[model samples]
Target: MTVLGIETTTDVCGVALNRNGVQLDSIVKNEKHIHAAQLVPMIENLLSRNQLKVFELDGIAVSIGPGSFTGLRIGLSVAKGLAYSSHLPLAAVSTLQSLAYPVWKTIPATESIILSVTEIQRDEFAYALFRAIDFIENHVPDFHLITKNEKETVEKIFENPLHHFLLCGFQAEKFYSMFCSENRNVSFAGKEFNACSATSIASLGERYLERNVIADVSSLEPVYGKNFIAKKSNLFSRITQ
Candidate 1:
């Protein structure tokens, strides 16, 4: 299956052409806050370089957020347009899961837990913990995406970190330090630990596609920023026009 994956949910803007889990050509830019302007051109460039068109793709995989609001919108806008025009299946992959793969690739696979976190600002965060124990057993990273968020709660849940944990993402450093400040039994992830990858996103989408887990194109809403409704009071305050 040839899948075209587009990800702009965070600081990174990437487009990858993955043929059945193996990435062929991918373009990634990590210039912070450039997602809105860079996402489409990056995808167009990647597709043009590969000489592939929309009709040649089997599915459209997108990182359905928990990232930036504007970034998510820009990516979804293009994705929805392409899927609608090409009549292809649209697949959604979690932002956090996409972060887990590189970190998972670095570890021993089993007997270790991965705690992935992204900064949410306002002194809070978004995080998920996955027991990569299955990766070591030959089942190919069959771990569930577990939530460990809202600050104080995750701190309590992982008080004893004997299971060899690795943390990665935008605010991974912050969380790592938080655990240490509490004197929790957690290990640290160096600069060499992990970063989001388009190939990983494509691979993850391929897994869901093979399982017949798909969604209706029109029904494919941008993830993450779904709850960012305009505050009613704020709206009322600016109605002087």
Candidate 2:
């Protein structure tokens, strides 16, 4: 399966071309907040260099949010456009899952737990817990948008002393320090595993495509993980508009 994967759920803007689970080419730019402008060109450049066309791709897979609102929107806009135009299936991979994927690929298969968390704002994060038994990731119920102040509650979740668990993703270091202070049986995934990779997105997407887990392009939306609140204007402010 030939797939084009996009990872822009964070500050990174990444694109990858994967054929049958093998990554052919990828581009990543971590220049803070330029994903909106860089994503499309990155995709075009990668496809052009590989001598591939958008229409030739079997599917488009995107890391559908829990990160920057604008970044996710830009990536999804492009992916949905390409999928709609090419008549290709669209696959949605969770941002946390993409972050957890590299760790899973490198970890030894054992009955362990993986906690994936990506920074959302101030002290808050987008987090999910996965129980990896025999190399399969079983997601624990209810994704969370947690803050540092909620450490006590988070601590209770990782208080399990029997299972070997790893905390990973954007703020792994921060979580590592927090968990270690409590003497929890938790380890960090390391600096190299910080950013989400489009290549990983492609691989996961390929599996989704094979399983016919395609998304409805017209209705697909990034998982914001929270309700968006629009600011309301007072009478005077509305009158000015």
Candidate 3:
């Protein structure tokens, strides 16, 4: 199966092609505030270079985020559009899952825990916990927003001494220092694993596709970690008046 993955959940704007579980090609640019302008073009370029077409892809995958709000919208919009136009399946991969995927692939499933986190604001973060026993199960399935002082919540999650913890994603080091400093089994993932990847999104998407876990293009929404209240502006009203 061939899948096109779009990732714009943070500063990175990336597009990747995964064919039969192998990454065919990818384009990733870590530039802030450029996702709106460059995402579709990057997808086009990636497909063109890979000698593939939108209709040829078996499915489309996107990072549905608990990250940058604007970036998530742009990525999901593009992915939904492409899927709708091409009549392809859509997979909504979690941004946190994408951040932990690379590390999960290398680690043994011996009571290992992957803690994926991203900063939401000063001293606040959104986190997802995955336990790799038989397979990676999202032990903490939902993204929970918490502050640095919420040591009780974090400690409860990491109470298993037998579980080796792998901390990853944006501000992972900060979180580690804040909570896991004294834990002998806890460690930080490399800098490369700190960012979300389109490749990982694509790879996970393929698995979702195989399992028939496709997303509803019409209603699928990014997980913003909290209620997204849009600031009302009267610019349109003023212009109309």
The candidate that achieves the highest lDDT relative to the unseen native structure: 3
Full ranking by lDDT: 3, 2, 1
1 versus 2: better TM-score goes to: 2
- List ranges where model 1 is wrong by over 4 Å: 134-151, 160-162, 181-184, 230-241
After superposing candidate 2, which stretches have Cα over 4 Å from the reference?
A: 134-141, 229-241
Cα lDDT tens digits for candidate 2, 1-241:
9999999888788999899879899999988889766777787788889888787889999998788777777788788878876789999888888788888888766777778888877677888877665333231134788777777777787666787677789877876665445554777778988888899889888888897888998787777766763222121121112
The lDDT per prediction is: 0.67, 0.77, 0.81
Model 2 lDDT on a 0 to 1 scale: 0.77
lDDT of 1 by residue, 29-90 (tens): 98878875667667767777888777778888887767777767767767766766777777
Q: Could you tell me how far off, in angstroms, the CA of residue 211 lies in candidate 1 after the best superposition?
A: 1.5
Give me candidate 1's TM-score against the actual structure. 0.80
Each prediction's total of clashing residue pairs, residues at least 3 apart in sequence or on different chains, is 0, 0, 0
Q: Over all chains combined, what TM-score does candidate 2 have?
A: 0.89
Query: Is candidate 1 or 2 superior in lDDT?
Result: 2
Pairs in steric clash, model 2: none
